[model samples]
Target: MYQPPHFKEERLDVQHALIQAHPLGLLVTNGSSGLIANPIPFALDASASPLGTLRAHLSRANQQWRDFDPAQEALVVFQGVESYITPSWYEAKRETGKVVPTWNYVIVQAYGRMRAIDDPEWLLRQISDVTRHQEAGRPEPWSTADAPADFLAAQLKGIVGVEIEVTRIEGKWKVSQNRSDTDRQRVAAGLRDDAHEEAHAMADLVETRGAKS
Candidate 1:
């Protein structure tokens, strides 16, 4: 991850928060199968390690798990709010016509040694934890116990659990922080007016994160 000083997010809590909010991460590994990437939903246990621990499951048929190399580290990328920033939104565009379009986003990258677990007990716990996290806000939440025992057991046989003790993590929040105050404010206003959920989220980031500039 490129780290420009102005955009770096160094707080561990902030990094973990982004991962929890965007649990679906792009798991990247380089092993016998070469570079392979899969989109997997993960559960983060902040207390599990100094950095954190990531728990996820992959279909038994997915070769990525089998290709895991203990000698190499794995990377999981979590992407948060992202939106396009138009030059038209910058006051500098009108003042000097020197502004260019760019992107505003928040993202976190976690790197750690990969471990694959085939034990049924671990798999059960991994799935339950992930399920509980995702269903937390729902009016009618579902649970792994809701399924028939035999059926759930049979289904669990088809997947494998993965755990990664995150050793390194990086966060970048590029929310118009490089722009001048007037330009950043104008960008936020334009994003808010777009009336889209993601754009509005980016607008809030611009207001809060860019304010530190």
Candidate 2:
């Protein structure tokens, strides 16, 4: 993550919140075959480490897990609200015609040594936690316990548990903080009018930053 001073988000609470909101992470690792990345949903356990620990699962058929070495480091990237910022949304564009388009987004990169667990008990708990977290917002939540014992057991056998004790985390929140108040406000307004989830999310974040200033 190339984090400029103005864009870096160092607050632990904020970082955790972003990870929670964006549970899916791109797990990246290097092996003899070369670099491989897989998108996996993670469960965060803050108590596991100062930076936090990530829990996930990979398909047993996925060679990346088998190829991954415990001694090597892996990176998990979590992306939050993101949207394109057009020059038309900037007041400075009209004032000086110098502003160009850019992007506003939030992202967190976690680096740590990954451990692969084949224990059925650990796998059960890991999948249960992930399902519970993701299903919480639904009108009718689903659970691993909903399946029959034999069926769930067979399903669990097809995956392996993954855990990472995070050693480092980098957070970047590029939310128009570099722009003037007027320009930032205009950007927010433009995003809000776009009527897309990501756009509205970015707009809210930009507006929140303005309020703090």
Candidate 3:
């Protein structure tokens, strides 16, 4: 959460959209016991609202769900592509004696209060919707009816559904935004040639975001 001005991402709409492309977020909440974090694959519904909506489920027996009091806000973290910045990538460092290691990546943070969905039918609907979303481009799409009604009903009983209506979001795209154009170009080119897959990912992020401006 400690982000410098140079690394902060200000485009809210675009930020929201980016995370949804990979909506598996780390959900964190706090209560009397302590802080709890759950890595959940979520269904992000943009049409739900300007702040968007998050839908996910957890094991019914998992006490964490009950401890997620609606009064206490929750944080959902969507981690985008990231890569390390090698010292050799900086053209400025090649001439000047100023250089260090850093990382470039995109991440979105969503804050909101969570509410439990008690309606089994609504939960079923959400489950179906999420399945469809994930299997959108798959040749063999999976449907909710894959399981027998009795089986699904029993499975649903073992899970607790949740909805998080986002209240605030912080998007940070730390891709050498503060660097000079020449420095950025040098870094991008170097990263593109990097053997590490993560490095190439960072290069692509820089180019994609840079073009927008």
- Each candidate's number of clashing pairs is 0, 0, 0
**TM-score versus the correct structure, for each prediction:** 0.97, 0.96, 0.90
Judging by TM-score, tell me the better candidate of 1 and 2.
Answer: 1
The lDDT per prediction is 0.92, 0.90, 0.83
Off by over 4 Å in 1: 211-213
Q: Rank the models by TM-score, top first.
A: 1, 2, 3
Instruction: Report the C-alpha lDDT of model 1 over 69-159, residue by residue, as the tens digit.
Output: 8889999999999999999987777789987889888999999999999999999998899899889989999999999999999998999
Whole-model lDDT, model 2 = 0.90
Q: Could you tell which candidate, 1 or 3, scores higher by TM-score?
A: 1
RMSD, each candidate, Å? Answer: 1.0, 1.5, 2.1
2 versus 3: better TM-score goes to: 2
- Report the error of model 1 at residue 161, Å: 0.8
TM-score of 3: 0.90
Model 1, position 145, has a per-residue lDDT of 92
Tell me the tens digit of each residue's lDDT in model 3 across 35-123: 99888878887778778888888888877788867898899999988887777767768799598888888899998999887678978
- Candidate 3, residue 51: how far the Cα is off, in Å: 0.9
Candidate 1 lDDT at 175 equals: 92
Instruction: Count backbone overlaps in model 1.
Output: 0
